[model samples]
Target: MEIERKLLKRSSLERLVDMMRSDGNMIYAPQKKETQVVFDTIETFADMTEDYIVSNQSPKFVAFPKIEKILDFSISQEGIRQEGTQLAAFPPVVVLGCRPCDADGFDSLTAIFNWDYKDELYNERLKRTTLISISCAQKDDYCFCTSVKGHPGSTRGSDILLTRFDGGDYLAEIVTEKGKALTEKYAALFEADPGIEKDKFLAEVKPRFEVEGLVQKCMGMFEHPVWIEQSLRCIGCGACAYVCPTCACFDIQDEAAVSKGERIRCWDSCGFGLFTIHTSGHNPREVQSQRWRQRVLHKFSYMPERLGVIGCVGCGRCSRACPVDMNLSEHLINIAEV
Candidate 1:
């Protein structure tokens, strides 16, 4: 479909949020949480914070939650019974004010969940969700979305992309059917297109390194000493994977008392020491350096070869969240130069 551009005044945005909530859609927006800006459930437009470059965490949890129940089982005297999660029960969600990089992370998650096995639960939640992203007008040193084929104004995964003009109004680009439906529903809120250039209002994020070249360099660096040198201070806390938008490793466990239990899927990380532990008490990645190498190689090499998608979205949340001050973009640049 041809993209439709429109102008949305500041007041219209507040009204749109009200309309969406009245229409039974759960609205997720970035709000100030003490010192951090994070995505949380909002009751009104006033609940959102306008001064953040990016949320401390991505909105990935809306679909692929940090912890989720997949199945329930019960053992009776007669036989064992099992019940699966109802995918259809997932609620309609609108992620408002996410950055373009945060929106783009969904593609990586989709590729992983759909490869070799289809996760209907995840697909169902994603289908019911709509993304309303705002273009970034400012960035910090940690941001590197441009290095990974993304832009501040890119509309790759957003249903609606809104770029804020100098006057505080938004240049709303309806990029998908879901976005068009939203505007159509609230036609009164959206005005005619004002013909403003979106790029002029977006942040200038310089590309740190060519992704293709970085990928090629990573393929030959498996035995390189860079991994050990860079991972010397890593404490194996898995903070990077937790804050990352595209890391999809998970572990499944069952919680029960005696006869009844529920199977849960929780987030996991390649940075952890026990992530690749074997049943024979052997670990393929015995040291922190090997585990750190797995983290980089999986994102830059393995996922691209197998799933045709890069597992990292260059959101920079991992770098900011790292307690040891391990900057991922700097590490990638050094790797490329090496």
Candidate 2:
């Protein structure tokens, strides 16, 4: 499936936006405001900005949503009426400029949504959208995808992949059938070029982990002291779950306004003190240490032991969103020993 093709230069990102528009697809990217890049729909060429580390929030919400209105219930003189609502229409969507770590999180998350309960809403939206994953040569201290099982120039859940070239050009690689078709449609925008530097390009992108023993090593430690030491500063505010790319716990409640009441499911977090509280005024994981233990166990041990795949994407959103600066990678590295 390897093919040599001319890539889009840094200057031609505007042209890519035009390609998205002409094909009747809705494009969502890291749009530039005044100083920062936020996820939104672009109007002109000025909105496309992929230079930021990661957004304040993960792009998962753009597809799954934080809190969604599934249906409406009304009680009138005629007794009661229930009005149902399905997930939105399957609009052709392009989640442009998502990184390799950004895209891999979705593949790890897709399992939970499709396991015992088939969430058609999440799956349908995913089916329609195209993820353009990337590999960043520029990384900081906290960007540690290599530790577990991730790489900078990796193709995880990307339909299309892009790598930064030496002279402002991108090495565009198609990872899926959808990406191949999309590229074929925009064939005029690309040139068929023979790549002479394939080995050099592959050498530039190397995975950092000896992934064979990671899961087994992570599975053997349950009562390890690192959980207490690592999570000592945590306050259990649930902010990590709020900003996570793969944390999928939710709570459903009935909202009664006037005459109409709707049953809604909103995102919930295991990190919150109230998350494990019983109706009899008893709480299990009232302490932050216990909550943090659950976080690691769920990602490394419980999830892998049960679901066959780990629960984290190494996106560092949890670490980024922590008020006390509780870094996940720093903590996980300590646990990697056991």
Task: Give the candidate number with the greatest lDDT.
Answer: 1
Lowest summed lDDT window (length 10), candidate 2: 198-207
**In order, what lDDT does every prediction score?**
0.93, 0.73
TM-score of each: 0.98, 0.88
Q: Residue by residue across 24-54, what tens digits does model 2's lDDT show?
A: 8888887767764567776655677757776
| Candidate 2 overall lDDT versus native | 0.73
Residues 236-257 of candidate 1 have per-residue lDDT tens digits of: 9999998888988999999998
After superposing candidate 2, which stretches have Cα over 4 Å from the reference? 1-6, 10-12, 32-36, 88-90, 194-214
Give the local distance difference test score of model 1.
Answer: 0.93
Q: Give the 10-residue window scoring lowest on summed lDDT in candidate 1.
A: 305-314
